[model samples]
Target: MSAIPVKSKIDRDQLLKISPFKEVIKPTVPHKHADYFELILLEQGGGYHVIDDQRYEVLPPTVYFMKPGQTHCWDFSRIPKGYVILFREELLTRECLDVAYNLPVNITLNDVETLPGLTRQFCDDYRAGASPAILKAYLQLIVLKTGEEARTQSAEGRFTPLYYQFRSLVNEHFHQVRKIQAYANMLHIPAAQLNLICKSASGKTPSMLLNERIVLEAKTLLSNTDLSIKEITDVLDFSDPSNFVKFFKLYTSFTPKQYREMAIARLH
Candidate 1:
């Protein structure tokens, strides 16, 4: 079976959801969530989570995160007990939301850590219909803590505002703009300067980072939707389907069709 694109049904006005996994069952599939963020706390479960085509073994007392439109699914050896937290960008505004992205996609917390306590507190606040400000504050703490842990091993000065702005631009326009020079122009810096900034902050050239974003979107469309090769090519703004296949193969070592088949095989 093909992977699915699953959009969370939470209303626009309702910005967050907190649910106990044992009580409220939710969809588990090789799928993509359209326009929200997810924070998962697997307090007790052992399994593998396939997210963005990377396999992460689920260890209890750990938390996982998903950004908008990311493809993911869970394969559990047995039912797991955890808390699922869902929220939209509206809840954090721009500044607060950056903290969320500062974090890596997943984190495993130490058992003695107080993070689990914070997660439990979030559940209580969510159930009591706490004020939006209070709820956002708790989430901010959680998001900040997760980010702090992620940055622990990172050398200083690796994450700067320029790098983050570059990422934001790539996320929004990668399909339309593939040239690193254009990205640098938009950010009002020389192409050489942009490369150096990216190399210092992220250890990759700007072009490499830009192309990765394009490939990621192409993979998501190819794996999670029924769009044909030509349609995917045009959607990604390639000149033709052949170039799309070539680029896909260059990065993935598989043609679009082969990659889709592989993604489906993993799901089953």
Candidate 2:
């Protein structure tokens, strides 16, 4: 079975890089980035961007927040003009990481006037080989502005630190650790309180979130890789392949083989 390709758009030793979107736009395979987060601001564009299993229209003045490990591919109908910022987690503070994780997959910025200038300056600074501190400051400002605009669009409540920590833990251990109570224990909180925090922040129970992560992984593997059902089941840590099939059908209403066939059809 073929494995999904992993791409590292940034350099091995660099913590951050910024460039114009047009500079990097090209044919892309459905792929994952394992080591860095990507922030994109599209001043003008047209096409659909598929992230995991969701497809988003490439609207102008849009900001896309892609966390590490997401599987995505770009299909553009028009040349896109924008900036792409790639940064490792070391460049972010806990607060910035929280915002990054919690923001929508893509946000349409209401005001394009200031953000373009800010991104231009950021691109220029990176080209000049600015110090890490200076680069971090610029990244923080860009995140801050984009996040504020997202808040204005969604008007969602503030995401607490505990919620972000919960998400981080789940992302790191979803395959082996599936129990909500176990996550609560790791956070030193009662299961009941964990439920409250998750509900308030995301409108979903902790179990739902955990299961969603598992389902997303299953979909990514099924869609992008040549793994058979048995191999995929083992990779997901299911005790039996039948159980994995059942679980996947319960969430997605399609068996692994069926999903893979459908994905293959779409690619052609």
Candidate 3:
């Protein structure tokens, strides 16, 4: 099968870019960027955006936060007017990543002008040769402002430090450390307390979260790379290829091969 295209719209030497959305939008295809996070702000919108195998409707005054290594594409029935902000992980803080991790893939805001206003300022500053520090500050403000509009104060506070720490550990070591107890050991908490903290913060058990992360990486490899099933199984640290197929099918209802076929078919 042919490989899915990996787009590098950002310059290799640059970590930040703020540009008009019109310049970037084109006919849709299943593609990914491995190096940067994308923040899309649309003043006018009519489209459907597919991200990581989930479809989201494009609504006006919309904000979409896409992390590194995510697969996405867009089909617009009506043209969208907006701005796109691209920044590398080095430009973000822990709080910014946490906010992005916790929020929905896209947010429809009631106060439309505020985010666009921020984007406009960001664009203006970027065009005026602003320093990296100033650009980083604006980027943080845009993220925090979106977080403010997308969730309540109590909701934001619901996620404790332990919860974030658990997620970080899982993201870093899900392939090697698969058990809730193992994660709890790393966090110095009882497995039951870890479960409770995860469930309380996100309504997902630790096991579910770990499995989800594994499934996500599996899907990424299946759809975006040319790895064989056995190779992917090894990359994911599964003991056997058949077991990996079963695990993927359990969460996604499609085996790795089937998912890859489906993902490749989207390009046509």
Candidate 4:
């Protein structure tokens, strides 16, 4: 018998054009993507989905979201039928959607059954040749539902605008600003206030979050590129190679060389 193929799909541009009707794939296996977000609704069958470091059982009427850069894999011992939507971050802008991006990163459909009819309606509408404007409207509605569910079910507080601003700044300047005060200065907020906002929203201080984001980027570079640590440090503007090494160790408990070795081992 032929081995089952691991099918991986990624779209980093506009929202993917997808069929709203249920899709069935048999004997599919595990896969991962580097950049893309996926929303999956399972209509039938049993399997498992691994997102990041967590695994979840797959059952009928199940829903899940997978963010970019996270690894996900699914079991296919039994064929599964479902509607899957793939979209990019740019598809929904914070300015356009009023901070929809602040919604929780993941959700389960079973917990939010109050909207199955609405979700089904959306699928039906899309399948029935809905216009792009209609589809976008439906998508925003879905996001709003998810956000409401998250707010009701999650113990974490909603992301404040200050926290959102800090996250955006980190995304834009993580390579350039290594200190919490630098970001606070850029935002014209006191360092202590920034820390308070980040802590209230994400349970981490601004400096910790900033360092963690930088470390994540550094790990990606170390794993995917052939650049030397010195070159990577220069690109990330760490002032010196030694400072970069110290920063990486402080956040990751691994020196640059050790982290690279571990990453190379995993690839092999």
* Clash count in backbone of candidate 4: 0
What lDDT does each candidate get? 0.77, 0.85, 0.82, 0.65
Query: Whose TM-score is greatest here?
Result: 2
Q: Roughly what TM-score does model 1 have, to 2 decimal places? A: 0.78
Please give the ranking of all candidate structures by lDDT, highest first, separated by commas: 2, 3, 1, 4
Each prediction's TM-score versus the true structure = 0.78, 0.85, 0.73, 0.61
Which stretches of candidate 4 lie above 4 Å from their native place? 1-106, 111-117, 127-137, 147-155, 179-192, 223-227, 260-268
CA error at residue 143 for candidate 3, angstroms: 1.0
Error of 2 at 233 (Å): 1.2
lDDT at 28 for candidate 3? Answer: 81
Per-model clash counts, in order, read 0, 0, 0, 0
Tens-digit lDDT track for model 2 on 9-76?
Answer: 88989888898887344756788887688998998878889899777999998988888778898888
Worst 10 residues of 3 by lDDT: 152-161
Alpha-carbon lDDT of model 1: 0.77
Off-target runs (Cα >4 Å) in candidate 1 are 1-6, 13-15, 22-27, 88-99, 151-157, 179-196, 221-228, 257-268
lDDT of 2 at 235: 80
lDDT score of residue 20 within candidate 1: 77
User: Model 4, range 114-157, lDDT digits (tens) per residue?
Assistant: 55666677778878888888887776666667666555445555
In candidate 1, list every pair of residues with a backbone clash.
none
